[model samples]
Target: MQLKEFSFICPVIESAVVLKAIETVTSPDAIAQTLGNTDSVEERKRKLPSQLVVCLIIAMSLWSSDSMGTVLKNLVNGLSRQWTKLGQYWKVPNSLSISAARQRVGCRVMSQLFERVVRPLATEETPGAFLGELRVYYSYR
Candidate 1:
């Protein structure tokens, strides 16, 4: 039996796709207003800025099964050029940093963000989306 050649290559994601999803969902101004965050005051800083972290959180949610680092890896790999232009050097934070950033961003902000960004997929065209003016629940999972 002949062995098949395998090559590993990750597809690049356009900045517009990711940014558009975020723009539709949440904005930097909205997040800062919600979180009451001020501009960075530290003289020295690490790679994981809060704004990037927020985007990372969304990406992580989209890819729930992947480790945070893996999710970040795929996202950064896909958007390397854009990230570079933004003066961001892609470095996946350790698990501890992820935890801290989550806290720093706050659960309330994230919750409100989800409420605003995430909407019911049901529409008039979808079956039973509106049953006699009462909404239908789909996918209990």
Candidate 2:
């Protein structure tokens, strides 16, 4: 029998690609506004600032099957240099810290983020987006 190296590519979307697409749709100003509106902005800088947490929450959704730590790592790893200012002492937070940061931000931040950025992709004439004369929406709640 011949031996060959085994390799498999993950089906999960790359963090950089998704983050770029998301950033394009949701501007930094929009994110800041949402965080401010929800009163979830951090008072002091930390490893996971409120802005970073907001992005982390968004990245979490894209990588649902991944652990929070993994999602966070992927997000930080994918960010551009300007997004972070650490030299070399920073490290990925443990699961508990990530959870704490998320809790501090709370549900309102996520809700506000959605409200500020989410918009209907279909227009009145788009097929299948409407049912008869009414517009159809996918309700998660």
Candidate 3:
């Protein structure tokens, strides 16, 4: 179905609010500042601002998948299809590639992205209830 034709069963938070929150937290400037004085080569890739990489990692974490293999499988069977429909970038990677990328990218980058983007976009009490609950539940588990 076209994105415009799909509707949530419940009240939905505004995408603008979520995007704005992401922008506020993950601003290029903020990322740059975080990378400052760091010797890591991964930090230099900030010049690219890889939305696909960030989205995949966040998706994996949100889905409560325990391993990169599971994450990659889910991405191929689930998220990639949606992303393709939305005209967003998505790719299926082998387990080894997924592991390599995850290791190279590291949790620090994902943590910072979550802190800056997803955290603020979360509901006032928590923004998207199901999403928030899932995140909290998965995080502790």
Candidate 4:
């Protein structure tokens, strides 16, 4: 609350968008191939496809919270460009829809995708990353 205290605080700025980082780490095409979750089935008429759902799940993991709906809305706001490019206006799916979509993708597929995509985000020099002689990695999610 004091001017001297304020002067000691440095302004932090984010130089990257999370969606861009996600795209660099993994792509929808890759997820589709991994899960066989292509949009080939025209009869389902699902607004939320398996690929997008997979990304949403990953995004949810990144921006973790007690509420899935909150995570999804945040994902939508963060990755608005990707959704807008799909030729349809995107809206955050309801809890039921999210559940259904997740079920449609199946837990097995998600597990596999997570194994394939998730990686250690810390460098060897990061604090407390190693205990004794063993190398350690931390997962934020």
Which of 1 and 4 is ahead in TM-score? 4
Q: How far is candidate 2 from the true structure (C-alpha RMSD, Å)?
A: 9.0
Please state the error at residue 139 of candidate 4 in Å.
6.4
Most lDDT-accurate candidate: 2
Give the runs in model 3 whose Cα sits over 4 Å from its true position.
Answer: 1-50, 65-91, 119-141
What value does the lDDT take at residue 107 in candidate 2? 91
lDDT of 4 by residue, 1-141 (tens): 212222213343121345656666676656766776433322565667666777778776656644778766665566647543443566777899998888777777777767877766545675787787677854533
lDDT of each: 0.60, 0.75, 0.45, 0.63
Please, what is the TM-score per model? 0.60, 0.76, 0.38, 0.61
Best by TM-score: 2
Residue 141's lDDT within candidate 4 is 33
Which has the better TM-score: candidate 1, or candidate 2? 2
Candidate 1: clashing residue pairs, number: 0
Candidate 2 C-alpha error for residue 17, in Å: 2.9
How many angstroms is residue 57 displaced in model 4 relative to the true structure, after the best TM-score fit?
1.3
Q: Between 2 and 4, whose lDDT is larger?
A: 2
What's the true lDDT of residue 93 in model 1?
A: 72
Over the stretch 44-121, how does candidate 3's per-residue lDDT look in tens digits? 443213343454565554445356555444444443232324333544556666656656556676566556545333
Model 1 lowest lDDT segment of ten? 1-10
RMSDs, each prediction? 9.8, 9.0, 9.6, 8.2
User: Which residue pairs overlap in candidate 4's backbone?
Assistant: none
